[model samples]
Target: MSDGEELTLADEIVARARIHAREVIDESELAVDLGALEWDVSARARRRAGLCRWHADREVATIVLARRAYERYDWPDFAGIVRHELVHAWEFQQFGESGHGDRFRERAAALEAPRYCEAFARPRYVLRCLAADCDWRAKRHRASKPVKSPDQYRCGGCGGSYEVEHVASGRTWTTASGYGGAKSALGEEW
Candidate 1:
């Protein structure tokens, strides 16, 4: 392997997840095997930090960690993410239940796990006022379905109607000018 080759992080994660499950469910009880663990870099930022997929027919489960968010979190945060997924796994195996129902909430509370299962994605669109020398903007989710005529919405700062200024992934934004078309300073419309 090259110097930059990634190590077996998935293996360690799987082992840790199993340990967490066993702790909650008890050692005498049969723990659900975390058969597969993968760091999915391709997963969208909107997705939760970790997801536990249970396979009833195969009697196994897989844990998928969002690589981008995982990379940013410290060990404690990462463990919390793992414990959150494990709670789901334990609940599924022991009770055959899904979703954040009463049972799931009760079990999670006993184990002191994170309540939320999903995370919100970063804003994908930006709306800015068209008024010259006025600086006002808004960040919107991809699913927000921006209005057909964004110009109808007034800016909070200058009380001017808003116009679509930037559209892209991440937090970067570009100015949309009627005279010059589009220009960006520090990747912001202002």
Candidate 2:
């Protein structure tokens, strides 16, 4: 596609983003642009098709669309993703809130947006059984230290030992130590 064609899509994205932003906090002075929506490919594995990055000092927010993930969805689904991020943008821009807090919920409800986005295809962490013929698998996001060791736990299916594996979700993992978990958290293991 030519540069002009690319700009058209970008323009549409910004226009739509602005519309969604106005839905929550309607302000004529609210200046938004496509400068915020970056095209990224790794958002698929991370399970986020769109992301909103807010800048307090500049009074600007950026929305990133996972190119690969966005391509898989229909126009309606893609628009929903844009709307979802806009809710976040509105929350941050108008109310100075960044999380799914009460104000965010209130605005989200007023906009009639989805409560949550779809989950990632893969879990941040995976647990597999070492014993042969036992197809046991468990998934989780956080792991505390003892949980990383295979000796402390056993698979209920064949009494096999457990092993821990961590997968990169296109983001850095920042934490001190190994991993640990409760039996209840591993509900499917039993």
User: Taking the tens digit of each residue's C-alpha lDDT, what string does model 2 give over 1-190?
Assistant: 4666555544555555556555534533333344443332243345567777777777676777665445577766766676667677755666555777776676556556565666535566666777789998766655544245556667657877766665552222212223333333445552
> What is the Å distance of residue 169 in model 2 from its true position?
18
**Model 1 C-alpha lDDT per residue in residues 1-190, reported as the tens digit of each score:** 5898776655555555456555655632335444432223324545467787767776455566676555667766666676677667766666665678787677566666677754535554567777899987776654233323454446778887766544542223222233123333424542
lDDT of residue 103 for candidate 2: 66
> All candidates: CA RMSD in angstroms?
8.1, 10.4
Q: What lDDT score goes with residue 78 in model 2?
A: 68
Q: What TM-score does candidate 1 reach?
A: 0.52
| Regions of model 2 farther than 4 Å from truth | 1-45, 124-190
Candidate 1: where is the Cα deviation over 4 Å? 1-6, 15-46, 117-121, 125-190
Question: What are the TM-scores, per candidate, against the unseen true structure?
Answer: 0.52, 0.51
